[model samples]
Target: MPRARPPPPPPRRMEAPPLPGFSEEQFRAACRELDQPAPAAGGPWQLLVESMGVRIYRLYDEQSGLYEYKIFGGLADCPPKLCADVYMDLDFRKQWDQYVKELHEKIYDGEKVIYWEVKYPFPLSNRDYVYIRECREMDVDGRKIWVVLAQSVSVPQCPEKPGIVRVKNYKQSLAIESDGKTGSKVYMYYFDNPGGMIPSWLVNWAAKSGVPTFLKDMQKACCNYSKNT
Candidate 1:
């Protein structure tokens, strides 16, 4: 009798979602808009919040250009793609290796959208708040206008390590396209103080200290150089 063939080796797994900010639909849409085919559809495409050890509810909104993702309640490691200066869909393990390396050297360069996870211990009797700032250039009538920006506190409802400590007194602002008459809109995401459990400290202190401010200045300097040269 002839030997039976093996069962096709169970199809290969798909890639994980881009990042927390990118949902299935939004990612799909963005890929489609760029004339790129969507990543394969399968069981492994979803992200496993190692801390929570569960899959998150991912939602998408093409109209406002946003993707809403919900997780448990703790600090989740930064998604490799989101934390990278460049964006590419690659193996999580591979991307994570680079993430840790860049983080250690404090030379991680982020692309268009910067997603950072800042942590500080709770019960801050003597400490400063963590802030997130975006370096952006304003354009008016197709011409570069002014370089204006600001920094604000951001509170992330991390999933995984819950009940111990959470981000409180969160104040985050996003630059939104406002009606031409109203100039531009700056939206805010704020919350009350958080529970004091973890010490008011940081996980990557050297990496973030004054980095955002430095980046903002760097952008302005580049624009000035371009104009002169």
Candidate 2:
């Protein structure tokens, strides 16, 4: 009989502290900024900030996309012990800063990241008002996940409606990987509409309507296709 394969090796743990290079003050500052509220009033369009403003502090490992530390939310309000493991590691901060810089640069060209649709369910009749927004991909966990950082602006409501409304939306997607020779996996996380903004009405309508159906259909299409091996 063939010898049994050796047991898979145990998972190795990192010994570093969180965000080594950055000081507690720095982390606190970043968190504070993230928690700050957006401007109340704005120009022609009402502006509200999106939740994508997370100050992610992660520690990368040998594993393709493993994360050692992930701190989300403002420092003051965030769980004090969230990333206690490596919250003080020096090398981690160096890498974190580099990643943040790259992320900022990616935001400028977000139109190329993820595609968005102006109208929900289906495009408009003339399709003239349709807009496609792109999502920026960031390395999260051990792989590239689409991340969108958006700021909101107040906009006029319906001509009949009296007051403006505040809405929050996010849009991001990830292309699951398949064997390089075979191509990619079909599963995708369509985060939000263009610019990552969704009106409250859209959210309610989507849950009641058939957006979930669209998502499932997309997934099936990807899963059913066979590579041209």
Worst 10 residues of 2 by lDDT: 99-108
How far is 47's C-alpha from truth in model 2 (Å)? 23
The runs of at least 3 residues in candidate 2 whose Cα sits more than 4 Å from the true structure, single-residue gaps closed, are: 1-128, 141-143, 147-206, 225-229
Please give each candidate's TM-score.
0.24, 0.23
Kindly list the per-residue Cα lDDT of model 1 for residues 1-229, writing each as its tens digit. Answer: 9999878887786643332232334222222221211223453223322222212322344553333332212112322112221112122323332222111111122213222333333433222233333333334445322221223233332232433333323333222222233232212122223434323234123122322332333223333332433
Scored by lDDT, model 1 comes in at 0.28
Q: Please, what is the whole-model Cα lDDT of each candidate in the order they appear?
A: 0.28, 0.27
* lDDT, residue 167, model 1: 36
**Which window of 10 residues has the lowest lDDT sum in candidate 1?**
99-108
Model 2: per-residue lDDT, tens digit, 1-229? 9999999999997533221122334323323322232322342222221232322222334433322222222222212122221122223323322211111111222221211112233332110111123223333344432222222222222121222221233322222222223332222222222223445565444333333343333333333222211
Error of 2 at 54 (Å): 23
